[model samples]
Target: MRFLGSRGLIAAAALAGTLVTAPAAEAAPASCAVADAMVSAGNYWLEHGTNLAAPDWQNATFHVGNLATVRTTGVSNHKTLPWAKANGYLLQNDPKRPFFPDFEAAGEAYLDLYTYFHPDPPILADLRSRISAEVASVAQGHDDYWNYVDALNMAMPSFARIGLLDQDESILDTMQKLFHHAEKEIGLFDEATGLWYRDARYVGTGTFWARGNGWALAALTKVLQVLPASDPRRPEYLRVFTKMANTLRFTQRGDGFWNSDLLRPWHYGGPESSGTAMFTYGLAWGVNAGILDAARFRPVVDRGWKALSTKALRPDGRFGYVQPVGAAPGPAKPADTAAYGVGAFLLTGQQVANLTPGC
Candidate 1:
């Protein structure tokens, strides 16, 4: 029986067998070209969009990071611009969980396109509608749609980006409210550890999943990146960002990758690409943006990027050791790869390029 996925395409599940991994020595150049190498990966994936994972978070992530590469490397905006146009410039939908931020992941790409390549109304029409509806609903009652840490990375930046574009303080206000709810009422965050449990499951288990916290750090970085200078919540966001950076600085493995279980390495200890890339993106942005001290965090970014670009990256742009979709830590083998991991790699590359021009 022939099964079809979205738009009558092969189901995304079929791509699982098509992940294509290379030996650590294969596909890697002796001296990696940060922007060139990353965009090559972006270009490859964009060239083969059909062979990717779930559209909601995974491919959406690739778009966001690839667009960032386009911004930095001056590569052709050919693929994403047309891809966005074909998608009708709307936020991705998940009818089953209509309000879940997982579906909102793609909006980050839309917002990026709106900000840089095209400031067209069609690009933001759906984003504006959904965010407005959300703001109104939030005023009427409480919603815990952002109950998990992963959602923070997926949606908070979208809110902040839209807020910046429309100068809608209400949207920004609502974003802050939900974020704090996750931290306080939901109790997913531990200020003392500077890490957040992926969800309630790991809350008391002494397990701090690396990618989950990395997602949180990436969320904080993106939100702060776009938040207005006069915004009052800057202090809180900065506090969390810095605290996480400090904690991660100590947890990074000697070889540069972060173990899947950061606090407890034995809980599936190994190199995980996505989490390390997220950490690198956050730390590199922190140092480049002057939020992190060069003396302390610069080395961390350097080490993380070195490992990500060399170890995780195959010469042809396929990244390795990417933990597959899941909430908690698990083994991330050298052969495992994902587009979201590629996106994370791009995000880190752009910032790393900013810090070290020749990197």
Candidate 2:
């Protein structure tokens, strides 16, 4: 189950008016309720969402988190194997955006299937061809490929995984090159605030988006998850992860959710599940990994799980309040939901499931 990759506060006692004056009494009961809730939501998604093998950013991401759920629950491999086979184990490389990261976002899920199931060699063929081309492109002095913040998670983690799998440090180094371009050359990251702008336009605009930071943090955590502890570059990514975690620790709303506009919560002030679940996933991962102090971050993880399980997730298993795709902060209503949002929840649930009674 270590192919990859805790929590508490029986988020079962969820909402007290969109914003609770104080969080409900929450703790990680011995039941490990988060995992059970995770499976419930996962089943909701499986029944209502698209077929798992659909080649798109949303479904690809769902697959990434769904597989994590499978491992956490010890569910059989029926869905993943058949799906990977139906799709021919290919990455989503659209002809128009040949190197577009979204098109290739499926690489993360594909690689996970290979690692978890140890599928046939053909499972890696599309990644080798397409990502090898990407490596060559980066080597040829092309650093602008990761033009947006989401690309960090959409594609970079897959590159890092391939680097470790192939035992190619150069590919890992190339990933840093692209990250450097986006983080520094493009000035998308704001170290002064320990957050990242969604793209070049959002820089210097005094607007730190919740989902944007969620995407960046999840990517950093994913990279660390797959990187060797002894790798010299591990600390660099580790610093970025902890700094962002520290910033988020202060900005979380009282109701256990982060508003879409992080600093200016008034912009779209409400419980946003996509960003909240993703942030929760990263914090839980950091704590379980021992890079983040448990005392400092466990409360944040607790509040987040409570909010998601209680507030955003509907009784019928629909995880809602996800702001529709955009570059800036926007309002998310209870009825608003997507596969990607549910995917973030699934990822969060697996991590929360690992928490040992929140201590």
Candidate 3:
């Protein structure tokens, strides 16, 4: 129950309730400062040990994103990198396992660490070798490998990161092929709404789960961050990001958050912090990249940051209202929290910190 070790702050935040709303708001603290505080506090709460490694994408994705957050925020070197290195820079899957995107998620952290500290370091040799072998053997023709929208976030960015690090452009081509296969062949992208379905269940329906699309948008941003402009796929990736940002702009809640289900606002009908945080991170990144119209998107990011800082955060810094891990939209209560949601908040805060005011 004592998530952040700051129950007093949590109590105060609970009483405050729904900190930021639209149409004229109080001038809040600077974005970077707020972001740094949340990241620091989140680290304090999660308390992941130095040697922990999970075989699933859920834990792997959060740590990778956490590394990004720490680097962006200028926090002094934290335990996450050390933990990753201590774990041998390996993902959940061994060479014997069949190809799966989630198993590749931890490679992002490994590559980030290798690039940041030392080049061609032995720390990353295992991951680099394993990924190369897997791609050679398993990815023969993009046969629906990345079937789920969330898997995009789990694996695509890692491929782009590793490809750029190794100067292997062809490896990047493989990533693009798999991405195109999922988005185009698998019926994931809903052309009309500019959002992605979690899978087949919500494809034709108007149900756009906020977190589902968040994974897609976040994955695209991560891929673009490292993807070269000369790559022929750049245009299509940019186009998809822009379209999703436009649709997200329209669906933002009056309170600056997004409902669990995007179109059916009343579905879960409450403040879902993880989805809101992911969108805030993606949209803010878009604005920083000049892919989104800053003037139009800035207010959306601002409201989201306020909502995150106020309603979602306990004064001590624990994130709240994160829906438990699920494939579709359902009930998300204010007290529900998870490590992935905390990662989403940290990622959002880091991007918000980078934004410059005014278009």
Candidate 4:
């Protein structure tokens, strides 16, 4: 229940000090203050929780977009589906398969909020059990194009956190296995291009999906953060992450966003907010973790923050132009609003909060 004991509290206080010491002149923009606001917002939704499938975007039960709405405005309708169903309970239409990808995203959201708020132990335990059960069920014999990767990414943070809390070796081993499977399945090295593919095999017209790559980049950074420095796999994860980061850097648009299609802009439209936000978060994390050159990445990060703060955010703090859920890059229509887009925005804002003072 109380994962952060005296030692953890001390470490967190030290980390907070490092974060706050950055000069006030470099403070994050006012709108960006919601980065910290998420702790309260997330807690409000969890406490006054609603059903997950009310089709009301204002409730916490809706997808990533709905979550964003809840973060911005704490009032959500009760018609929302219960947390279980909202978090990808199996549908009768697709009974055999769970909505693993959505569960993964929701799991991350819950875990991230938990880190900041240190929610009631029962709340934390319930979420952990649900997520772990979904992951264990999905991992038993499931295989899909990208669902496995999604599940692994979603499960890693929770498992690591749980392991740290209970000294649970099984949890740690599960995390390791998930990572290995994800690397072998989705990760590919291109000798000619010296970049990693979004998946192991390259379709003739295939290029890296910006968000998918973002997911991978973020996952690797998170995994490495928890992995022991001496772990043999740590260096390999770093190597892959570096390669992906370089490719991402070269692909960044002059406007500070990645194109919908990471390889070629001609085929796709302009810069995408969701992918750009994810990449911004990933790059910022890399710099903060000392795995990448901050100077080299700062401009990109700055441009990204400016673009998101100015272009994507509405006056009410709603994030737009997020590409809706899909496996690969597609038409960036105005109608394609997604919760993950807002999630990505929040993620970027959170990182920017840390960067502003430090810069």
Highest TM-score against the true fold, candidate: 2
What are the per-model C-alpha RMSD values against the true structure?
10.4, 9.1, 10.2, 7.0
- Displacement of residue 73 (Cα, Å) in model 3 is 3.5
Candidate 1 versus the native: TM-score? 0.88
User: What is the lDDT of every predicted structure here?
Assistant: 0.79, 0.80, 0.72, 0.54
- For candidate 2, write residues 135-212 as lDDT tens digits: 898888888989888889898888887777677778888889889899999998899999999999989998998888
Report, for all candidates in order, the number of backbone clashes. Answer: 2, 6, 2, 10
Q: Which candidate leads in lDDT?
A: 2
Better of 2 and 4 by TM-score: 2
- Could you tell me the lDDT of residue 268 within candidate 3? 86
Q: Give a tens-digit lDDT track for model 4, residues 1-359.
A: 11233333443344223323322122233354444333333333344433434322122212332333333333233222344345443212223444344343444444433443333344355545654564465467543423333343445555655555555555565565556655554444453443444554453345767776766676676667666676555676788778878877888888787887788788676758878887887787787778889888877788887777676665444556677667677666543445456556655655565576521
Measured against the true structure, the TM-scores of the candidates, in listed sequence, are: 0.88, 0.89, 0.84, 0.69
TM-score of 3: 0.84
Clash total of candidate 3: 2
Report the C-alpha lDDT of model 1 over 233-302, residue by residue, as the tens digit: 8889989999999999999999999999999877787889999999999999999889899999999998
